[model samples]
Target: MLIGAGYFFELLCTGQLKPVAGQPIFQETRFGWVVSGPADNVINSGGWAASAVNLSITENTETDLEQSITTFWKLEEYESKSVYTKEEKECESHFDNNINRDESGRFRVRLPFKKNDYKRDTQLKQDYIKCMSEYEALEHMERVDNEIENKDREGKYYIPHHAVRNDSSTTTKLRVVFDALIAEDRRDFQHVLWRPEPTQPIHVYRLNTLTYGTVPASYLATACLENLANTECDSCPEVGELIIRDFYMDDYLGGAMSKAGAIQLRDDLISIMSKAGLELRKWLSNDPELIVNVHSDNNNIRGRGQCPDSQAKILSEIATIFDPLGLFGPVIIIAKIIMQKLWQIKVNWDDVLPDNICAEWQRYRDGLPSLNNLRIPRKIISNKIVVITEIHGFVDASEKAYGACLYLRTTGVHKNIDVKLICAKSNVAPLKIVSLPRLELCAALLLSRLRNKLIPKLNLKINRRRFWTDSKVVLAWITSPSGRWKTFVAHRVCEIQELAACSEWSHVPTHDNAADV
Candidate 1:
């Protein structure tokens, strides 16, 4: 059976269609009510239906006569039979619900929608937005990248206008040179280069400007590139590669795995830079033969020697080389504690230290000379396949501090399981009083995060992971449901589980925990 356009549209929009005396266009569906005729397309249109009766109002001020009509529709959820209502009062209420007198007066409307529909439509709009965002993703084209780009890579490489004084002999005559870009103060200070001095009345000589002082960063980089460009390195590519990243400003600092490579790089550097009028004179090396070749004038010019006695005095003055591996974290932590103690007493910039502080500082300083004795192996060759490799993390907290440390253990690679301190981190406890258990939990979570990060870079295939903590309370908390704990414990437990789900949690005697150190 076919329905008229008006009836069909009403069926689509309102979930109701009454054919002239005999036909029905509405049908039952799993989703309340929907249109039955024409095609397979259907909607849960019952959710969109207005109130019971349809209200039509028409106003004609020209005659002062207004007419309104009310009509009924069947509902599938509650109505099995058609119901009819013709109440003028229902029209008045619907009109009042939607009306707020405006310049465009509501003259006439065959109540298109009942009052309640507008409220639900507005509320559901946000949910529809979410639904479209999720379900419509595959149907639509991916969003275009509209962000404006700056040529940052090009900008990073730009040299400063002027750098490095050509005449400065603490340095040498550069094989390459650059023009000096004058400073703001010297903008009007330019006298023509190759010209006579200002004091001299004679301008007849070819004008020349005198240049002096430190060179800018830009000129230095360009000069370095130019020098390398001129130097021949086709036969010694390894030395050339070392020189590329090794130079810091004008000084070279680099390392090699083999003494032979070190000797070769040193000799090549001396020969190559000499072409640019630069001398590689002060060479120091661990290998005796390499040192003998350069024959450094200073007797103490030995690599990996003890710290100078004077360098041992000032904590801040001596270079604290950035140790990413945390080999000397315990030693560094001592210095950090001393610094914090100094701050606690409100020590001024130039304050003389208390005798106890100075004595302790001196003792720590004396121990630093011995730290040079520690060395990381260049390589650990193992033929046997790794049977098991495990990372063990230990966490601890005190009134003053909290920390976490990791160790890597490997078996089958060695007769006795080889173990090494992988990395460690520590934090001073906050001034606010906190329960020891909470701090212990914080340390565990920190170690879990460290495990997540270091796992990707580890060369050995890890078979197991473990976390150690002395705090029984924290252990109880982790083994228990998250809801059993308070806010502090619950949040940290959730994070720890997320990051270290594969890790086993275990108790460790406080004396045995390396993190306690």
Candidate 2:
């Protein structure tokens, strides 16, 4: 017996919600009533005779049924905490094993052969509200106070939304391209909860304001702009694609190969996103001419582009380097390793680090400033022509962590072999640690993942793809057929074999493996 708090909140905004039997409901309602067998779902804001439910729905004049362009959530009247309804407060919170009961011992179901004609229309409207409420519930769970702000891992000049863009995408279609869900910081399915401010009472939202720095917010915002780009400006297909693909969350972490192409893309991206009511800001370009044309000097942008002051300082990380591509893999791994050691000792967020941990963390932070000098040229050889190219991957593991890296070795016009590190990944050994060989197998798997991603990301043609690993056992595991190893090694090896062939793997001395470093 539950009605969405969001729908009710919407009506409250337009002054349409009224107390019905002491239950808040709009004069015109979506879910007419889905109360219990002999009882109603809602009673009052006070203690209910049975279960209590309320919905905030707005009565709009033009009536397209109704929906919110801004917010995706509204909580149960004031369910700050979850306690069983008095009816079944003692034992367990479930109607029966057959029914889908939530932790709060509340649920609703469609009754078969319930109605036709007038009743059918009511049923359809209920379905709409139920579907919308469920979807909004999912979206709300995604954007609560929990947040993950990615530091400016790649030291680029102009980054949008700066530190917050690191939260990975949550869109259904594009979730696989970036990272995936790890362990969440808070409890799961935080349905129908929105607290705009901590000091004020917990009120439902009218605008879709998830956590400001959370992944769902950044992903949904960009996805909104991208969808708008497609539907609004179908004539400009290139602009639409760039809007969707080139962005990492809100930041445009992409570029074109030539000046004409870059300028055209830049202009189209800005114009398209702007049309969707999304403003592009902190526009940084290697081309000095391009930068001047796009950069805005005016400080006040009404929350459109750059937030007045963060115009120039977009190229550095605040705490951690989120180099998804392992350019700084080794150094970043070391920092994480130190953090792990500290965590092992059970230090809280505010606790001061021990001297050893503090020193290492400080060194890493200090070294980050030097990344400003380490420049990777934007032009993939604006001067030379490459006759041949090779993609090499290196993998290694220690007790603390395992890592992998990808390097492009190109034989250019002079037959010179120039090697450049593209991207890498470093994962800390699992808590219930496996053997070194298993960890090495994990590193190899990471290398394979990096290879699959790096190949598509790079705009180059390669003659060969190769992988190197320091561990002989991991190499044997890869070289052997899929089912030869035990469960742990077998699973990783299976993935590696699928992504990278046995012929592609080679054994290198521990010191020589770049990933080992």
Candidate 3:
């Protein structure tokens, strides 16, 4: 019997019915036709009728073979849902046990196999679709919707499942799920699954972009492109803001303005300043003279360099001195501070900071006391002026490896230690733009270079040239007792110790340290 609504069984063979003397017998298709032995045949032929035991496959031959297979076996027909549920358990068990059985309870019957078996392929595809549909329904049971929560912590928040899936970080998770599906599908063989392409951000062009207040769009564009590969989207906008701000503040306005270039980059800087919203008032300008301290050559500790700690101290002192009105002091005494302590890690400017770059610095000043007293001696201040040597690269051909510079100053004034670029004899070795620790060693080596070439060159020098940079970590590392800097910095430290026999160096904060500009 056909078990359920969408199914039918093909009758390949049939049983026969016996005829009686007075009654005509007919075969029935509903219940399988049954045959009985006749009494006369039972006596003559050992109780078996010839026609009763013999059965034949009924066929309309060529035409009926295809029609019968299609109609009764449902090679291409819609299966009712109820019939699917009825057959599901049996089919599932057969698949699970790697056994195949016909719906009529027949076993071990082999059908002719063909390469393009469309009926079996279609059934297999439908089975997977059913499984996936059921799987999604189960997974969605706990949460039908996603939610996101914004916490007050810095750089941190919670994202719901929907948000998580949308983020780039979740690409791996998607890949894992896809891999699992592929693995399940091709369980008998090893196979690789293809993944979707990753999405990338669009870069938009901005006009009126300022480079040192001069609108050097070309230079700014080049710098932006140089660091483009390192750029990631996490804080892309914030980094962009810094690029814009630094171009204006550092290249045009900072003490290192002349180092930027010709074309008088910011020829009308004052007008540019007007656009930036800084009004130059007469009373604001008249209050105090700007003092700039240049610590060009000491390697032991930062003596005159405006280290962050010292710079903070100086700003506080001025705030104390000028902060009477509470409002005016914050505006007046505090110098514009730009710190680049980590700039070395990000940029190795050995290419831009050329070899044999002309430099002049103030020699070490004597009669200076340690910073513990918080007083800068007058003699040291008055006598401070040293001729700076040309800074060169670590190699003759490569220009990227260049020496470090440190500068400090008060608000609103340019100090007499103003620098100008000029061609000079190539005397110093090129500096190496290695790691931070190595860079510190390079700075120390540069100081030692000054002592070797300058101390005897200056009759044992007045006292000692002060070295300054923004790396407090480097400073502490080099100055620590029994400091174990890497061999490069250690070697440089030894040179510094010998140079200390003549002069001293100091570490400074990046804010008050202007050389980074």
Candidate 4:
């Protein structure tokens, strides 16, 4: 009976069945009653057995996903290791042998496939037929003559393909994916699609261009772009450099100092990319006039949406701001402080914010509209030649945050002095309690880093750079030797010293420090 019970007695292992004190318990099953309780040691006294199992599952959070994506793309941006496999070498050789320019100067490339024969899947053939019918209707593929014999298919290989449909895709809602591993049998059969008709024989078709989802599609496309840039470098060096440095995949991101410079750069980019059969569209710029001629429909520009009423919505709104230079650091810091507070209290993203924070956020959101009235010169100074240029940086720290701002001071040929704010950056104070003097030092270090980064990028010939802070303790730390301070202070002071000389840093009255805002 026990043998036939099978898993009926498994509950005893689960510990859910409790024995009555000195009483036997019976459970009814298809095999009959089973008794279990505290019993005299009959077999246990002679032997002992033990078993254990452990399991763990970890999920990728949003932060982890973002970090992984950053790391993956960073590898692509840098040169690969100084090593190559046989397959890699072959791929490079094939690209060089088949890549060429057409009569219109557009680049043409071929697929890279290993020399191997692969078996075909029946389901793949059915999918290919269904997809090719749509492709022929759209005029994306043409049918070949049926007179071609099987002997003529020597260099041709059939590719297994299937259609993928995504309702959320803004562009092509449906696209066909070709499997590279199964499609590697023939070099000439890049994509062998077929369509059957009741009254006629099955027709064969092939995709002309490089198909997405292929193993070497991304490599081939990137190589083609690099080749275009290299070939055109002699005639358009600047544009070629921009294409190499500024392009992330198909998008081009760059800037110029003046309207004329921007226009010239735009024309050069269009001319060069057009040579490779690439036309840039949907151009966007901070200056409306720059894109007015290209995008005549002003409605295409995104307009402000309804005000955010929840924490999640507010965060989404904040992410939409496009201030890369941190020119609005002072105004933006308020929002950052609110966000930090929300995180501190461990507020749910979609939950209603606390009354105090919600009120503060609402006030900040309401005042944002007034920013339209604020204006600053795009260029630091007029086109007139300047004899002297200097960068002045200010830093300050409060109990809640620290910030740094830079100003460009120029002396024209007429001895006229012009001062303008160049850029600014700010950060919320760490949640860990810290001394005000330490915060002040952090601010000073922030200013040092900002100056060091801006100087290399600025086109002007800066004669001197100076930093200002309101904290006397910070000035003392900068003047004294870094070895005298603790690890935190010592590290920041050392970096600050390395970035700027002790003499370049000075003290300013609290009221006079612009960063105090």
Best candidate, TM-score-wise? 4
Give candidate 2's whole-model lDDT.
Answer: 0.58
Backbone clash numbers for all candidates listed = 12, 11, 32, 0
Tens-place lDDT per residue, model 1, 129-152, is 454465458664344345225534
For every candidate, C-alpha RMSD to the true structure in Å:
33.6, 22.1, 36.1, 15.3
Best by lDDT: 4
Better of 1 and 2 by TM-score: 2
Per-candidate local distance difference test: 0.57, 0.58, 0.33, 0.74
In model 1, which runs have C-alpha deviations exceeding 4 angstroms? 1-315, 318-321, 376-385, 413-416, 481-483
lDDT string for model 3 (203-261, tens) is 44332222232322343333332233123223344433333444432232122112232
Query: How close to the true structure is residue 360 of candidate 2, measured as C-alpha lDDT?
Result: 56
Q: Per-prediction TM-score, please?
A: 0.42, 0.52, 0.20, 0.62
lDDT value, residue 74 of candidate 1:
10
Ranking by lDDT: 4, 2, 1, 3
Model 4 alpha-carbon drift over 4 Å, by segment = 1-60, 63-102, 108-230, 233-236, 241-249, 255-258, 296-310
Model 2, stretches more than 4 Å misplaced? 1-239, 274-278, 286-289, 296-320, 378-383, 431-433
TM-score ranking, best first: 4, 2, 1, 3
The total of clashing pairs for model 3 equals: 32
Q: Model 1 has how many clashing residue pairs?
A: 12
